[model samples]
Target: MAVKITGSTGGWNCDFPRRQYMSPLFSAILLLLGLCLANAINFTTVYEWDKYDFVWPSGVNTSNEQIKWNVYFEYMAVFEERLFLSLEPFRGIPATLVWFPISGTSTAPPKLAPFPSWELHKKDNCDSIQAAKGMETDRDGRLWVLDQGSRNCSSKIWIFNLLNNDTTVRVHQFPDAVVSPSFDKRSLRDIVLDKTPDDNLAYLVDSKSENIIVYSRKTNKSWLVKTPGRKWVSLALSPIREERQLYLGKSGYKELYSASVTDCELKNEGRSAAVKLIGEWSYQPYRMLIDSSNVLYAAFFNQNYLCKWNISEPFREQRIHEVGEQDTDWPFTFALDTNGIFWMTERNDTGDWTKPRHKLLMAAVGARSYQFGTSTDLSLRG
Candidate 1:
């Protein structure tokens, strides 16, 4: 005769409570399986910070007028032997793209060269591409702009052609896969140009969708790079193959992921895909860069530290570099030079979200690397 088994709300619904109906041996086996599953479901590990403090650009007053930049530091990229950055100023006017030469020394109020006519106000339909964040000049010298056009998510990719010395531009709306995934309208945050030996493509980071979109240079087709279960804050590419890492952060968990490129060309057709996982931890990592040597450096907001990591091995380990946290209630963004140096900006502790302001910061990755600490006149000049 076979024994019948059943389940109940109170406990186990035992139609066979006796040894004749259910053996003690089988009951012991079921108990062990239940305990094992419960253990697996309740597993979690907590990590704590031992030492946290600021180190570079010390003794600087964030309240000073000369260092104050009344906008959000959205993008920083190297272009034309210099670094070109864009700041999203509040109120009416479109954001400004400023340039500065790549000198090792920190310049006061950093010299601001004239923004190219393409970046200035224009009457083209592309004018709606507002609040430019990521600015990169292509091989053809056309400026690629990533606009964070608010949560309404009607953002696009705007191009400024430099061929005719004209500001003629084109704007491409966000692809359906990116904007339709969320009930909330999506907005893009940053874009990095991923250059292959044959061609170049743009990796668009949309924080709202928690994914990156890959756009083809030839087809202009867009595909999603899924970053499941994580809100990616910023992404930086290493100049090497299949080794790009993304700096991801959220309310309580902040991490960097080692993303491996998977797709490859088939029969003269160029195709690529990628998947990533958490590689390291640096709470509240807003922006970061990977140097040619594969070392990862990132900035932390509110925690008051600029952290570094070594990803030469399979697992990335953190190398904490203490940085100044004073008055920098919000450390928004950062950049890296060809020489492996790092730069950042700090938001003043106003506590008012309505008015956003930041002071520029400069630092080097090594000791005795950053000498010109806080030079007021040179901070924003660039």
Candidate 2:
């Protein structure tokens, strides 16, 4: 499974000159870069974790067992040079949204601090994050979180202004008719943001409900597309707004599909958006994302490999690389930093549960995240 955007997603129009149509030269350059990334790139270990060491709030009642669990790191995003990770608020997890500066690299397990503050991560506060699986950051320095509220908290979308030192929070609680907190599980898994001068939109995957929920900032309302499948886990919008596409993948399926983001705007609560089959992979990609170059990257389920392809080309041409030597390296959350560094968190499935065996790794390939539009020559600026 490969994930990629066409380029031009809101907060992502920075990497290159925005164009309504991709020039032949631009496509060639993206192809070259994608090939360069497959040259057995050396991945550096920024830090590893066997147990998640969160900065526990002073007054919170957390059992010590919470830190040592084999809890998985689901999603990650980078903003303001800091890496943010979302830990699902499961049986013993304390915080769902946390971050640490990429500058201050620690040799020991990185100390994950609650974003904004510990106060904002208190479970069931309703005012805070209860459960989260996916998160994203934009060029404007805003952190967007999709909180799949537990039974105690209602599902809501949260936006924080990192530009203001994250002092402000804007939240939108989905109406129960479209989204209600589930006691058995969190339905909303992934979120993608599309921002432009004309409109601000968000697309999300409701796995259990089998729906694609579209929300608009302009209207301050949400609509649902009762999708055809049940496990719609992977999602992304084309980086180029003019050719916007919503790429999707399922947990067990090897094929990836896409739909037009515009077709999902219908106010019909039960409408189904038309989808097109993009392509398939030899292995199953459980999670994925795209880079500014329109290069789609995928992390296989419980596999030691990570693969990528220039979406402008055929899926058969995708370049797959073994990111690690360990069989336990189960890659999941991944995002590209501003400098073209590939960052991801991997779970050591066979490691000692008492220690921090999981690792956060980085590799440079001269590529930026799709959130940055496309590649550009900075010299052209001044």
Candidate 3:
């Protein structure tokens, strides 16, 4: 009495909906069926260095001399239920990939597997160059990889999905010629699934142009979310805003801009339209997530720090969590999960006056709830 489900690799069965057909075997398979549902996601403290706990399938650390690299994790996504991580490297290819799963409180560290070596040249559909700054997955399970095209002026966005019944790979190409309005066509920092409030259509962020090209499965006509003042790469829908607007942050720079998203259109240069200056440091603000309390958690690439901004209140005081030194393992990209924990990619130091030249390091920070401490029961945890 096991229910069969088709998976990517092989077929597996769980005792559930199929038990009705064979009720006699249900008693024997009840325990096994419970394990299948419980093992969906479990977290573990397997990654322990000194005092901090890490997420699973961490990067292989070379040069065991307590070395930490300062680089950026440009792209991050959950691919096929496994975590796909990439980083900025030096002397070799600029990209590396790590495969793992979403870890929970009962999860274990991912077992190490043989990784395919970084390729140097472009092959058929999947290019092996470097500088993969952004990555996003479509609802249909297609992966869209955005390469910086840094080395050869190859400002291109590559799309990859499975063909031949999910065996052979397929690719689609879009050149920079029909992409944007800016001349600094170096990198597409990040990709977001744009969900319009009014309709079922979504769009992707074209960072260089300070505009987002809207794509609808319903109609083929395209539109743009234009911001007149500055360019934006990281976009997040604010949870605390009254009108439920979109908050956009600049990539590779220190700035946070807000625009109301009504009917999937940006209400530009209006009274409700206001920009919040988090800081003036020159760093890339890559990925952002809105917490349950309406706070904006931002990760700065150049600086290994996690910035917390109170969007619900006036933007006067903001908290910054600097991890590594400017010349050390500065974070590049980061995300916060439902548990209020911060996950980031840590890179090796790119030497003084140099750039990042190492593999990836995964790190996490636990969030603690603080209360108003006084003569009351309100106390803060550190």
Candidate 4:
């Protein structure tokens, strides 16, 4: 007699002879079953906010009228156990930096706490960040803040050393050349840091200008790489493994564009070469992240499904899971941890935008973790 296990998909099936009790075929079948079970994806909520915990400084108004104003979270960065969040300056909130521990409380949901302390009038100063849209925590325990200069403020990158008491170590302001002449200020939406052996670089995306600005920390020089073909709504950097590539997502376009870091760094004065179209998707992604094995995870606009695309050969796009509802609004940004768990914020758009109804959620994307992989490669030939 023989025992046979058939997988849900037609491609996978295994058979074991009962006579050969502990044979290699039996062992392989057992391993395959274990792998299938281990790779199962699950979604779970880490933290939720029915309404934002607006804690103002002692002198500032803590009245319900003031706190009830709209405040939205656009981006987040996780370093160790601390989670850092940035508020978009849509409602003119004075405090921009808010953080809390990963292990949050249920009875008392994590309240938004100001980083570097909250102070009135600090919002207007160029030295201080007016509004930040995106942020990233590097391998060296340093946090990079991308201040978009939303309300007539200077666009700048503020680097803080989390290891050294969260002190500001470097501040780099974007020159006027990189900003678009049409807009009052460039919309610096997102940033990705590349700390390679030969070069230390930061790539910032100007959503309004449709350009990717590259900054070299070693040389203290900056340049621009314009998005080719179509305008990109968002940009994501692949994990530095064997090669580094930039992933650009456009709103209406079904295809995602990618380019090698080498081409992006090659300078013809202050501009780099345009990127080429790469993987095609069913829907335009709002945000995307690539893991160590080159698997692309994306969230789309007006869509309820979160998708994953295999960038390696035999390219395949699979809808991992669906979230929220077609009628409900979803978070514009999300992040992945070392363990492949995704952290995203969900807001209740059914209510007025002015009132806060945001929740921080987490979902386990995959079984394998990309924690040890380095994003330092740049092989981009298709």
Question: How many clashes does the backbone of model 1 have?
Answer: 21
- Native RMSD of candidate 3 (Å): 17.9
Candidate 2 C-alpha lDDT tens digits along 290-329: 8777778877766766667677787653444553334553
**lDDT at residue 209 of model 4 (Cα atoms):** 66
**Candidate 2, after superposition: displacement of residue 55 in Å?**
1.8
Every model's TM-score: 0.60, 0.80, 0.54, 0.78
Pairs in clash, predicted candidate 4? 239-375, 240-374, 240-375, 240-376, 242-377, 243-377, 243-378, 244-377, 244-378
- Tens digits of per-residue lDDT, candidate 4, 261-311, equal 755353324555567777678777766776666677777767766667766
- Flag the better candidate by TM-score, 1 or 3: 1
Q: Against the correct fold, how does model 3 do in TM-score? A: 0.54
- lDDT tens readout by residue for model 1, 55-94: 1133544343322234445677653446666766455333
Q: Provide the lDDT at 239 for model 2.
A: 67
- The best candidate by TM-score is 2
Off by over 4 Å in 4: 1-40, 65-69, 104-107, 119-121, 181-185, 264-269, 326-332, 351-356, 365-382
Ranking by TM-score: 2, 4, 1, 3
Badly placed stretches (over 4 Å) of model 3 are: 1-72, 79-81, 89-91, 94-98, 102-131, 137-144, 149-172, 175-184, 196-210, 213-224, 239-242, 251-253, 263-284, 324-332, 336-341, 348-382
Per-residue lDDT tens digits of candidate 3, residues 225-336? 5555667777665542236656677754666666555543532222223445544424556667554456566666555555566566765323343333545434445544
